[model samples]
Target: MSLRETVNSVDTNAKRQACMELINEDYNKLGQYKMGEVQSRNIMIIGRTRTGKSTIKLLLMDPRNVPDEMTLKSGTKDPQFQTFHIQQQEVVLNIIDTPGLFERSNVESDIRPDEAILKGIQLCANMEITKFHAICFCVALTSGINAQDVEAIEKLIAFLGDEIMNNSCLVITHCESKDEEQRNRLKLELEQDTFFKKINPFFKLGVYFSGSLNSDDYKHGNESLKNQYLTISDYRKKLLDLFIKIEKPFPISEMIISQIRQANDSVEQKTVQLEDEKQKNDELQSRIKELQEKYLKEKCLADDLRVKYEQQERLVTDSRVTHGQREGQLKNLQEKLQQKDNIIKRREKCQAQLGNDLKKIIEMEEHQTKKLEDNFYGRLRSVYDADKIRAVFLIPVRRIITDYLRYVITSFTVVK
Candidate 1:
């Protein structure tokens, strides 16, 4: 080969070795990067403010070397990524440490800690980490359980889901000086808490205690400090083992986030629907009340009208009775008046007949008296002296006959 070809060949081999080393580094730091193989086990540490979430991450990264002041005071305001390499078992651990969920801030920002953490998880997809092998919920042993802790846990469960609880574990920090008995007592207290009781069944990985000594204590060569460090290391090691042994990983992807948003929207819609239904029910009840009042008023009016109608009917009946009595009385009065008129006509007719009979009797008496005088005078003249007979007999007989006639007439008139 020529000089130029040799130089090119050496450069090519150097580049090939460097690439192999890079690939090997990636394989050791993360698990086998090959598709379909179990890669690095991803873990997310979550907790409220100042609960030692960052401290736990540091200790897990280097359990033998105590964290310096810088690492201890490094409050994570954003998601921090770290990798742990276990060359002996060829296991890799990828950890994402998030900001405290309940950290107080004077400056209000649009992105909340929880929202930022979700964005960080989304960024992990670019690194080929689509799921979390485990979620560690860190709570300080010194900080007694409070409402804030409960609220943070509830928020996490709401955002992620109850499925996340299946791969979760509790980490009690600040337990460096606590004895086994004290730790057990704290655990029992946690179990007894109402909020913990509801979610205890979902913690499949169980609880753990993490305690760490400063670097200064480790450098003093004290046996007790060394033993304490070993115990802390063992606790962290067990946590890693648990992560590696997880059978399934909780998915963190855009699709999952979308699903969570949809669920929240559905709950809001149901709440609105319930409010609308309650309002409608109230309106219907009001309408019913109005209708009842109207019905009562109408009923009262109907009753009054019925009473008046009954009264009018009674009046008409009474009037009819009075009218019938009046008609009968008028009929009797007419019959009496008719009888009086008939009696008056009969009396007038009888008076007229009596006057005619009296006139006829007077005429008959005058004619009879004249005839007797004429016959007596003729007889006296033939039998005796005319002058003497006329003077004596004529006078006496005339007087007697007149008297008799008067008596007869008076008696007959009285008898008739």
Candidate 2:
């Protein structure tokens, strides 16, 4: 996830994951030896001038049972680096106590306090062994919320952005009130302010009411400072818990650098995406052209096929007309053939009738010839016994008989 997502949302797990990302990267750079080793973590202390950022830094290192080691010295003007350990955990802590945030000109140069702190945090990032774990914003409750305080915070937020802001906690310090009612009044004032709410939107991690670590000029045992200092034990423990909540420690400088590099990368990414889109659009246009040409060719083919179909239809119509005429002529020829068949049948009947008539005529002629032969035999026998008047007829008959007998005898002799 991006750094903006980690800080903009109210999800602790997201912020933890973001911290781990930088931590794992640092581990990679540290090499194989540090991979399994628990390395030291760092915390950045930031606040306006005289808000006791140095006191918080020292108290964290060692909850002071006594006053300042060197009484003459006041607040640190330059970035101070210190290392301390917690008894509960084995991890070491490197504190980067940034010089107070304000308008003070640098003693050696014209650099402002905010600019110096930026350089200091960058310096912390350069250290190979220590990574910034959490940030602590020191606030003096006795002053209540003021515009000057709000201005200082806005400057810090502008410098670091939300990544540093979200991982940070507001430390309410310098509460001199001894009575509960007085402390409640301070709390009520802080609660009503819009600026305090803006900073501590998530959780109020640490508040120092009893212990006050002031400049060397201010006596350590002053009742107000003493009361604030007495709260140091709880602050020390709770500050450790806040760092633990961060889960992994990474340099704030790394986050700033990463975000800057991402902007540069987006320019290049945009160019590549545009080129890819243009290539895809060109391919689509080419495909559409091919389909359009194919459609025109198919349309021409369809037109030709339609013309041929119309010609075939005309031919079929002509053939049907011709077939109808041929069928009519065939019917007339069939009628003539039927007439010739009737005439042939009548001729065959007449021929059969003529054959039967000829058969009857032949039978009648045979019967008449037999009857005439019988009559002639009877007449010749009767004339043979006739008297003298028939003598002449008998003489002729006898002569005829003699001649017939002679002819018969000669025929018989020729036959023998």
Candidate with top lDDT is: 1
Error of 2 at 92 (Å): 1.3
Give candidate 2 regions above 4 Å deviation: 1-39, 68-74, 106-113, 129-131, 176-185, 202-230, 248-416
lDDT of 2 at 324: 78
* Best candidate (score: TM-score): 1
lDDT of 1 at 80: 75
Please count the clashing residue pairs in each candidate, in the order shown: 0, 9
Whole-structure CA lDDT of model 1: 0.74
Residue-by-residue lDDT tens digits, candidate 1, 1-416: 99999999999999999999998898888966454433578888877667788778777777765655533233877777778776655667888887777665656532344564554565465566778888888888767667666666676777677888888888988776667788799899998987777657766789998877755566786677766677778777888778767868988767765664565467579889989998999999999999999999999999999999999999999999999998898888888888877876665565456546755765575566557666777777788887787777777776786677678657655654
Give me the displacement of residue 135 in model 1, in angstroms: 0.3
Evaluate residue 358 in candidate 2 and report its C-alpha lDDT on the 0 to 100 scale: 40
Clashing pairs in 1: none
For model 1, the stretches where C-alpha displacement exceeds 4 angstroms are: 1-38, 68-74, 108-113, 215-223, 257-416
What's the lDDT for residue 139 in model 2? Answer: 70
lDDT of 2: 0.61
TM-score of 2: 0.43
When summed lDDT is taken over every stretch of 10 residues in candidate 1, the lowest stretch is 65-74
